[model samples]
Target: MTSTAKTPLPPAACATALDPTAEPFYLQVLQALDAAGVPYVVGGAFALAGLTGVERPTKDLDLFVRRADFDRLDAVLGDAGLRSELTFPHWLGKVYKGAFFIDFIFASANGLNPVDDGWFERAGRATILGHPVRTMSAEDMLWSKAFIMERERYDGADVAHVLRGCGAALDWHHLMDRAGPHWRVLLSHLVLFGYVYPDERDRIPAWVMHELLRKLHDEMLAPPPASGRIQGTLLSREQYLADLRHGAGDARLKPAGTMSAEEIAAWTAAIGEPHEK
Candidate 1:
């Protein structure tokens, strides 16, 4: 709802596939971002398409950049005639060049995964719309998509596909650290990945499962939390408003994350707005 409005391209045009040609504006934006020397990795459907080899039309390109680079990114876009604005200062921004636009996302919709320098260090190369670009690693993509379980859109299948397509190459130890306090979300996706691709269950390393299982076993034995905080908001900010309104602790709040109440409110209010993350 807060984008620098443009005569946006239809979903059928300017797709983010490896060989798209319906729209040329996306390429221009990507070229500008690259020329600026600011670190970013392709994300959203294109990144998944790169990892899974399933091409599909995307409304906009997703460029994952760090918060520290927002100002520089905005300035660079402006110089190139691509109007940019911080759509949600907490996590997302948008750059518009007439009919085509791209998202400059710095954090997850749930305010969980914040883009960091390590992402570029671990990035894999890909060709999007014929432009050679870096992409989010399979582990980072899986980690970020694991929590996208809204009623309208769920990325569980994406997570499963990443595991099936590139699970063997994933650095499980690094992934474990990425999940950190959210290891259970990672484990759930892994369990389902094995279920979804029973023939490829061997793709998962044995020790990873053992470690997660031991953690689960220990937690199940421990006493339940007396506070009973409803952290489901961390997975879908729009779907869990009722619980938060009833005084449940929003995991997006501090001590848990860097998002503030005002930021959470802005992000929450932007739900259902067209062309959102």
Candidate 2:
């Protein structure tokens, strides 16, 4: 098998933080999707929090769907008056609606998209803005984050936060097995993020994270070949750091806009209850 070299983290990742408005938008999207009965699981940064417990606000909503349901998704969003900008069948697999964008991902871009199998099986339920929804399992979120680390795209903090939040709850064996050949890269990311301090490295349980790192170091010295085309959206370490610095105080970080009295009254007459207040 051809092995791919990992790219070093870019400087911009620490510079461009996600807009603080992303959280409310996320809630809005979830409500809209749930109301429409569209099956989706939150992924990417927002989903990462469910796994790692890192609480940085995300810039966009990342939702994954079965390939068979793509057309249905298109129809649903179209009816909602949301426009889509398709970016796949080329490099980046993405779909955008106004200020919101969702990355269309298959399970394995190189082989088969194994996204649907057991997707809900690995999800846990949570309430967002009084709406009930299912999210990715903490372990699965870690697996997804670990895979991203292999590509050398984002900061170790993302992974660090995951480790801190769900380390005790993670299934080390399952995580190792799912990480496949890219285990060491993930471990190095954890170390870089200060999640695994040098002095405390030995103390990390001999379970999944530690063993996976050790095995990858001893066995897979040659890395996997980069599969998907590298998207420019990948953030560098510097950008990630910068974002962390400024993201906390972003002005857009506030409660979502409440509907005006007229709008609320119209919605109450139309939907029979107050949807937004």
lDDT of each residue in 121-148, candidate 2, tens digit only: 7787655545666676666565555434
**Candidate whose TM-score is highest:** 1
Question: Model 1, 94-187: lDDT tens per residue?
Answer: 8876666788888887777899878999998877667888888888888888999898989899888788777767888999988887889989
Error of 2 at 103 (Å): 4.1
Off by over 4 Å in 1: 1-22
- Per-residue error for 219 in candidate 2, Å, reads 3.0
Could you estimate the TM-score for every candidate? 0.89, 0.57
